[model samples]
Target: MICMDTTTAALTRDEIARFHQQGYLGPYTACTPEDMAAVRLRIDAEVLTSTGPNPASPLHSRHLDHRPVHDLVTLPGVLGRVRGLLGDDIVLWSTFLFNKEPGTPEVPWHQDIDEWPLDPPVNLSIWMAIDEVTAENSCVQIIPGSHRELLHHVPSRPGMVFSKEIEPGLVDTSGAIDMELAPGEFFLFSEQLMHHSNKNDSNRRRLGLSARYTTPSVNIRDQDSAPCFPGHACVLVSGSDTQGLNRMTEPPA
Candidate 1:
């Protein structure tokens, strides 16, 4: 159930309306360009020494393992906007760093809900730019109003970062909008929105941070009913979970 209180809304009525109509919003700044540059530098160093089994593993859930990420996700500007959309009681379900290095292949068209386990499938994602992102450097692209329904997705081809992609011919791209963002700016979108990024043809690498938030009432379920998916740890970022349904992980020290 949605629990919105307009008096405390982080976004204006107009902004919220646009988001509902377009499936996405912003370029809102959460930090200064200089600050983001420093974050990028630190992430670069950490990536080199990350001991995870694969490159992607280390970048996942940095909010739980890294203090900086935890702080960023909890920032008033970021979390406030999220609260405006999803309500006061929120659970931080996941975080990811999408570092598209030069020459990396495009992220095929897809929806974030395709592989998730949420029973009601209600989620809002905040994608923040860690570096200047432009059309030439693979900025995120989305199809307006596509979040109204789930689209067909097929297994992605080899070498793709995502394992699933929107099936060919299922979506018309005539109204797609490129989400160009400057460093430290962020855009929030629904989990079911049809979105993708192109190959980074520019010489510079494209780095973006994604934080996924949802109401605690949404139950996580899968065919096997596993305790929790590996690396799919969750934490209560705000308010109480009176229903006591989600099993939350403690924030890392």
Candidate 2:
């Protein structure tokens, strides 16, 4: 199911102000709950037939190779908000599925910029829920205004998905907000935001899709420069890549 065009006004001045202050914005509705159910069914089928050993592995960067994901990431509702933050010229840098099955280990607190190689790190990540997310089911939680400066991270504990996590005593998370989202809803956040999730203590699984976007002016390292993956690809989601720094890949037919 395709996302519906958001008729609501683009991020308001107050909303943008809040986002700048808090490092994140919205659980905005992109698709109807019924539409999300259909999309989830299609994603499930793709996962079953995927080549990689697990859903997370095979579906990483699926936006560049999967039609539904390609369309989803480029949806006006998604891009409009991003454009509000990152400007009109946008490059889809990456995509991933963070599907946590019941009893999965908690994701360690970390900042996304630490793993990326872009100079002067700048990125906005849109995380869309494929299933209802709540505190009990490990919805995203983040420390408000943590994106002002890069924080130090240490190696993550065993069984965690990421290799690094925020070092102890670096930032107090006593006021971290639980970002509960319904199916088809999403939030836009700064890549440097210190965020993580708890283990899914509920019976149901938790599923989310993330699309990372950046302006074309940001110079992404080429494949030869310690690439994140051996064959990482990017897509020009909007405007032009005036810098011509990235090797843009065409979306799958």
What is candidate 2's lDDT per residue for 1-253, written digit by digit as tens?
Answer: 2666555336778888999998999888887888888778888898535843223368677776668777777777788888888888999988888889999988889999887878668889999998899998999998889898888989987888778898867868898999999998899999899899988889989999999888887887764343245577689988888888777888777
Candidate 1, residues 83-127: lDDT per residue as tens digits?
Answer: 878888999977888889898987989998888888788999999
Global lDDT for candidate 2? 0.82
Candidate 1 colliding pairs:
none
Measured against the true structure, the TM-scores of the candidates, in listed sequence, are 0.88, 0.92
Q: After superposition, how far is residue 116 of candidate 1 from its true place, in Å?
A: 0.6
Question: Would you list the C-alpha lDDT of every candidate in the order shown?
Answer: 0.79, 0.82
**Alpha carbon lDDT of residue 246, candidate 1?**
69
